[model samples]
Target: MVRKPDFKILYVDDEPKSLRYFKKTFSSDFIIVTADSGAEALDILSDAGNNIGILIADQRMPEMTGVEVIQKARSFAPEIVSLLITAYMDLDVALDAINGGHIFQFICKPWSTDSLKIMLLEAAQEYERNRHCLILEQKNRELEESRRTQERFIYTLSHEVRTPVGLSLNYSDALLESTLSEEQREYATSINVVNQSLLSVLDNTLDYSMWESGKLVLHEFPFKLSDLLERIEQAFGLQFKTANVNFVLKRSTEGIDNLVGDPDCLFQVLVNLLSNAIKYSAAGKEIELSIEILKSSDRSVDLRFAVTDTGEGIAKAIMDRLFKPFSQLQTAREGSGLGLLISKELVTMMGGEIGVNSEQGKGSEFWFEVEFWLGSDSSDGEEPLNGSRTVEGIPILLAEDSAVGQAMVDGLLSPGIQRGDR
Candidate 1:
């Protein structure tokens, strides 16, 4: 069933015959009000308090012209759109209606049913647009206020907390190096590490806030996935080893090894996923990393990526908000809860996506998929995919604006050309 429109319109004319005809024509579309004179129309509007959406007036009335009638109508309902009816001979009156009464539009007398219907619909659309724009401007002003509040909070947090924590970490480091017993030295080292961890959490918190505020910056460049994966493994190797977690790597597409992208963002994504997996998994469980080619239905192009994990499976409900920032679910007890959120944001900024799948008792698998350019260098390099043939010597372009990105891109595309600032 169609929903009935909720607007009420008031149509005024000094001719009773014309008024009756309008009542018959527009009774279904609007609440039609008729009057034999402008004075009677004003009396009706004044009595009803003008909650009207549209005011339609006939031009050649005696006591008052259509422009005069609508001009008075504005005082009753400032929000209502006024329209005037005029014949060709009353062109001057139509202009007068627009200038003196702020008429939204005018219709020629003897308007066709179709034309009238179109005019009313256009007026309704205009009303909705103006209403929404006003609402948007109001919302924007509130958002600006909220941003100011957040900036003040960050200022206080940085000054009031970070400085003292920094000094404590420095003193703890000094104490670790001094002439002390082995146990004391170990305790000092532990204190230093804990302090550093706390500091890192605080920093990540600030970064997360910046990201939430849409202020995070990304520097994209060419980087080797193999090299990036190696660096990540090296950093997390000790943690996995201590936990007795087995780490496995399987490559399927070597074409992406020397691909163009942001290495730091990619590394951060992998690190966050791997770190979380290690944190939540049972000791001695296996953490697998594997890449494969993904072909779209069209079969003309493909993408590549890896999934790594060794953790108790994520619950269905927990998995739903896994990527939401500051959303720490039962399945996520790894870092400050900002790691995956930041990682996901970084991956998206670099034109990639991260996803996860898991059963309740089985371990979860976190994966990242990125668009890879097929290269043609099968003879020289070992393929990331064991069985698939590698494309050779694909000409890849690297672009960057920052020094760090330039260096990263230069390193990734060793034998390829590098470009800056398109």
Candidate 2:
């Protein structure tokens, strides 16, 4: 069934007989309102509010010419499709009207009924097309502005949150270094966990804004998959103590070595999946980070990484919002909610895809697929990074603008390493 259009046609002429003939001819196929004079037509257009889609006016009206009426009608209905009717041959006037864009077309004294119908319908379609195009352009502008506003809010909020979060982490680190009772140590551990989560959220917001603005930076380096998993395991190994969750890295048995990719970005995406799993799981529950080799070639290998947890599964109602920022499920534990969003973005940047599968009563498995170029571990003449590298008495200059960044560098550096001003 065809949906009827909601707009109406407006015909203006000084002759009452012409008005009655136009209504009798086209009233069955179109909704129309008639005006006997240009002044009356302007009043109808001004009061019609958007109901008028087309206007057919007589050129030989005593008060005003058709071109004059159409030109002035624009003040009320700028996009109205217009056609002029004339009883005499006036090619110069017709050319001026068409060239000036005051009228869509001119009809001779005796117009064929069939030809006039076709022209009127075509003008209606043209009006519809132009209206839709203008609406689309306006919507696009609004969407762009909304995205800019969101980015600005994220940036402002991230900076405002940075100072307090950094102070909290610095304090927690100091407290952890000192000897403490079991309860005090547990309290410090909890604080550190929250601090790490905040840092992760801040990092994600910044990364997302950067990605949206086309300023995200990525690095490619050579490293073994096993080594990267081991590092993540070690980092999470300490954090898992707070919840007493069993965190395991189920590495693939394939001979995956010397992979070249953005390790930091991949690491962050994996950490997001794993941390989310940890958030939803209970104490004593096990969470597995597994990898599988999908396809391998001479220079590149495709792989799938998954983090599965035996926690209460997700509800279907919130699944659509799973990867949107600040849409964390209402669970026993709190989360930043930006992890999965940024994870999806990072995975895409790494030429990968990410998703999750779950049943309400069972558990959830969040997964991502990525491809990496195969290369030697060493680049240039420098030795490959390893666990035992030493930098005794080596002076390194630091130039970081973030307080948490400077503190992280400070903590990661060895005791023998010296830091100097650049």
Candidate 3:
């Protein structure tokens, strides 16, 4: 049998003859190191503790007892397996070694070679087991500390960054309500879009953290599926109109109007899909959203929602990691990279499966299938009027640092401009 590498056996005795005999007998089976006294054994340990796996000390030495040496050796390499060799069977010494927590076995002076070899093999195995356990324990502690640090950083970012973003959104909304020229309207719209995008990034970051911490919860209630689609159309209709892209929503042959589920989460997932479609597709490209009812019963209905886009299709390699957090494909446009990850998590929490199918040049289709409870009544299909068209006559104050933003604000609030020198 091959001996274990780096497993050194240290034999300590005041008598040189005993030490020499022990080394000569066991030198072939193990790396035997001889020490004349407790001091010499400790000196070897201090220099080669990492390589020394088993330490056997003779009792009744000149100055230090075996128990004392073993106890002191533990300070240098606490994981070393220790043994006590004695001619006299002193019960007190045996008890002391047993209770010290370091000694693994006690061998008499007249030990058979076979018995001593077996005990040493067992002691080496024990040392390895203890060392592995300590390594694993330390790894667990580091992981826990890292998680806590990430939690604190996310918390601080959410609180500190969102305040100004919220203020910018409100200011943009105020500007949109006021009367302005066509060019001025475009500028205000652009500003509103930028602020909204920033707010979206913030929201995605917060959602990712919540999901990672197992703190995200779903709230279910009665809602109309048709009404949800209508809201999505209104939200993206204006965006597509400005971008000159074709946006279509198709209902399946069999449609379910009323359902009981979390509307907010459903809306978020759809919005993320639509936003990506818009961001990646070139002008004049077509984007379509569809809903198909797969199965229906008295209590529940299974629906599959799909978004197909005629953009640059995802590569096979990129698609593999599409839903991973903070992972993004190389593109000219910028994104938070958390949208798809959050969308996948939300779909899973609602007991649904989300996936994507794409080809190199043929574009892509993303879909999710979820089951929801049937509602009591059907939807009326009444659409709400646009709020920006109705709300007017509110005096707005715009404080913007950027020149373009200031010009947009000034154009919106013309004829009431006041100048002050700085």
Candidate 4:
């Protein structure tokens, strides 16, 4: 069924007889409003412009021409579809007006009722299309503004958080080096671990923001696959051991050892997977890491790495959105909910595919397959600390704009301050 159009059709002419005839012809099909002159039509439009969709005006009026009235009416209601009616045989003026987009259609002095009705129908459809397009443009602008606002908020929050977290970590390290009892040392270590976790959350949140804004870039370098796996094992070994979860790593084939890729990104993906496994698995359960040689050639090698956890498996319904940003399946645990999302994006950026297999009762297996070219020169795979260094007994200058950040830094470094060092 066709819905009735709510907008009215406006007809303007210098002759009262033509106005009457137009209203009498189209009154049943549309809400017809008649004006006898261009000036009067402008007045009607100025009063009720939004309700008028189509404007049909006669040319050669005493006060103004149809094109003049249409050009002016467009300023008030830009979505109105305009039509020109003229009896004079001069085509130059009509052509100019049509080219200027002041008119949608031109009708001769003696226009057939059926053809005029069809033209009005087309004009109504055009008006609707223009309205819809305008709405979409407005919505897109709003969405872009919202995204920018969110990015700004995330950046500000991350900066505000990092200052204190960094100071805490530095102070905790100093405390660990100082003399203390076994219980005191344990307490300080716990504090340092918790602060490191907080710092990790902040870093992950910033990385997620970068990915959302399309600013994350991958840096490639030559590295040993075995070295990368060894680093992953070293990083998570203590955590898994403390949790009593068995951590296993199956080495890659001998031929596919050295490869060219982003070792930092590869290690991050593995760490995220292992961390999740450790977090979800129960004590005494097993968490296994294995690498399989999917395909190997002279230049490139494809390796599939899987992290299997003998923990409570995920439901089928939640599996689809498992990798979405801020989507956490186990809400009981504390997390930033961006680890899986960042891992997925990092894997894809490195020309890889990641997936998960799980059942309600059975455990979950998360795996990724990535291909890397075998590097020509052998690399020791010893990663340099990316611009990180420590210096002792050197007077350091700290510049922090926020007063709270300045106080936190001062408190953290007070123990190292000598007499008259203020």
Candidate 5:
């Protein structure tokens, strides 16, 4: 490959006629800078260190040798490639210089112009390669530091804001449950909705930061597929109804019911797909989720989850950018543009693959397939509730610094405690 004259070559010799001859020989092919002595060569290197890509100097100079000149130039311009011009008798010293890393190669006294041009080109290419690696390494270090900073910010923000959001949501729930007029109940419900949205944003941010820092982890536990579907239907069924969309959850549950996996991550992935479907869909549109059993055995099972929506379908132009971080199909929506990317990451971490099928004017289907270990069968034909083991008789001690946080925790745990489930 050939590059334009972006780099310069510096040649040094004590003979003025030789310097002139060298420049005229390759003046059209390369950018050549000549120096008559070692001192002049060092001065040029000092001023144009970055632009000079290759350095070639005569071994026998007036004050200092070419090896000394190249070694000194390397102190400030280590990325430059160096070659020695020597006679037959100076071959031994040139060999020492090459072995000691003072020069890259040596040329004989009566060098062929074609051979010398080829050597110079190779030297320039070597300099380019080294410079490219240095730049790439620097960029990687910067990216690593940025990821660390983002992780720290996510931690600090969550620690400070979680209590307040939790308090607001639980208090709103409490207020709605108490006796109140219709308007008051509606206002409390609105507060609950807003707080839930804020909490979702916070969760997504924290997940993205953890993923960037390679700290995102998935926990495995046993859960019933029916319960998982029930929770999702209970959570988003009303949202679909309110939007006047026909929503259905089709569960193919004949294969396996009890499985071990990360429920939270699977839930979030479904939620992201459903949320996007809700945004582009209009009234009277159709949205459906299908959970199909693909393969099953006594030890493990593989299943496919798909979300289909009849909305203004994705355009062909922007389809490839769907899963990229910070890329959105539509700029008018409200989001960090990380939902699809986060889903992809979570699905991959769980040993699954995600994809989409869409047309310009038709609807779209987003699907993923994952494998889960089968849980041990229960003799009583009963599974643990949402992956939580039995802790009915255990004494529990809760701790929190904020009163609001304590109240929220107490409110959340009271129902389970009353039912003697935890």
Candidate 6:
């Protein structure tokens, strides 16, 4: 298993014994980096550029107090979890640090080893939670941008569909007049064929929404992935023949035949990828599909699949928005721009992730990884999907600096709790 990124903690104090003691207590779980004073701690952080998951600093030092150090650390690394360890009861300074530096906890000095360890672990977990929230916020921003792009796409799709419909209507009207020449009648028939093709594209645009809303249910059963691939090939064979696009499909393992999944939804993802590959692919170029299994953790597996095309590759500037809904590579032409978005949503619904890699003029590869369950009871089976698990029951440690809020939380958590007068 790839080790979860180390949770780094920085402890700053004047006493070497205290630092050593704290290190000995939590060294196994946390990467504990220590300094004799606040200035030394700042030097260490600046030099190493430590991605400090948590910071624990002593209240009084020769140069600066724990609160001052945390306040300064906030400017350099605003996201690091901070804790203030103080021997003195300076309520005003502690409150200022909590508000200004966004400190996670305030630990009183002469602390118990057990309590301190538990507190640090809780802070680390909260740090990870915040990190995930930040990632989701970024994705949401990209989604917004994609929505704006789709607005333009809707206009473009409307224009593309309307032009053919208008032409077909005029040609049919002319044909019905009963005064058209033979050449004009032949032209009208051609217009009808073109209109049908345009309608097919429009149908694809509508199909995108179906897959997105989970309205398009998949047939779930045991089936060889290869059979599905063949079905895809048969379905898209005519498009390849018409476009003159070369196709290549490869599988890494032979024994990996059958999979327990919704093959129909999987087919839709493949079709969307393959369609994009062919549509954007340079005429007479090759498109390829490959599949393999990757171990994401000690007891989990992910099926990685990729579709590569030799076509106008995506630009780097827009790579960040590739998975975003309704994003087109470039708007030089017209499109609904929702193919990749719906494809991502479909894969995600099946406990998977989707991403893309592209280079200008060098073509692009769209890939997704789905949690894989082996046919046999392998040690590493499938795991729950991202964001699927909820915290059913866990202790919450709120380290609010406000006395009133702290009292309220304690009262709610335990009705009989009482605190001594200040």
lDDT of each: 0.70, 0.82, 0.81, 0.83, 0.82, 0.72
Q: lDDT tens digits, residues 1-422, model 4?
A: 45558998888889999999999888888889989888889988998644888999888788898888999999988888999998768467778889988889888879999999899999999999988988999999999999999998997899789878987776676676677798988787777767756766677777788888899888898888877987777555546756789887776676677799999888888878887888789999999999988998889989899999998888888889899866767565556678899999999999999999998677899999999888875534755544233345569899989775676667556665532232
**Lowest lDDT 10-residue stretch of candidate 2:** 413-422
Question: TM-score for each prediction?
Answer: 0.48, 0.62, 0.63, 0.66, 0.66, 0.41
Q: Write the per-residue lDDT of candidate 1 for residues 1-422, one digit (tens) a residue.
A: 44435666678887788778878887777666677777877777776554456778888889798888888867765556778889889988788767764798898988888899788878766656655776898899999998879876975686568766776675665575467797887677666656655665565666677776778787655556677877767555546666688988787764445555566766667766776777788888988877777763321224455555656688888887988866768344646787778777877776778888888777788887766443334435654654344233777776766565565445445543222111
Mind giving the per-residue lDDT tens digits that candidate 5 earns over 1-422? 45456889899999898889999998778889999989988888998644888999999987899999999999998888999999999999999999998888899978889999999889978998979988999999999888778779877798679768876766665676677797886677667766765765677777887888789999999887877888777556546755678888888868577789999889888878887787678889889899988888878888999999987788776778888888776575667677888999999999999999888577889899999999875535666355365555567798888776665556455545421121
Ordered list by lDDT, greatest first = 4, 5, 2, 3, 6, 1
User: Which is the better candidate, 1 or 4, if ranked by TM-score?
Assistant: 4
State, as a TM-score between 0 and 1, how close model 3 is to the true structure: 0.63
lDDT of 3 at 226: 74
Candidate 2 per-residue lDDT over residues 17-116, each given as its tens digit: 9899999998878888999999888888887664888889888898887878899987667778898998667667877889988888888878789999
Clashes of 4: 0
| TM-score: model 5 vs. ground truth | 0.66
Q: Quote the lDDT for 272 in model 3.
A: 87
Which residue pairs of candidate 2 clash? none
Evaluate model 3: give its lDDT.
0.81
Worst 10 residues of 1 by lDDT: 413-422
Flag the better candidate by lDDT, 4 or 6: 4
Q: Candidate 5, 200: how far from true, in Å? A: 3.3
lDDT by residue for model 6 (1-422), tens: 33434768899999999988988887777788898988888877665457777889888888798888887877776667888887657656666777774688788878988898888878888778877887898899999889767855764676667655754544453453455577876665555444544544554465564554346554566656767888777666656765688988877755675576787768878877887787788788999999887754443357789999988787788878766766665465355566677677778878888998988899999999887554443324556334344443557778888565565456445533322110
Which residue ranges in model 5 land beyond 4 Å of their true spot? Answer: 1-88, 99-101, 104-163, 241-246, 284-286, 316-320, 332-334, 359-362, 378-394, 412-422
Q: Model 1 TM-score?
A: 0.48
Q: After superposition, how far is residue 305 of candidate 1 from its true place, in Å?
A: 4.5
- Tens digits of per-residue lDDT, candidate 3, 1-422, equal 88554778888989999899999988887888989999989988888644787899988799998878899999878888899997766756866778767588888878899999899889878988978987998999999999989886996698578767776665655676677789988887777677666766677788788888888899999998877988787556657866778998888825567799999889888988888888888899999998888888989999999999998888888888888876768464467788899999999989999999998687899999999998877424644433223213667666778765676456445544322110
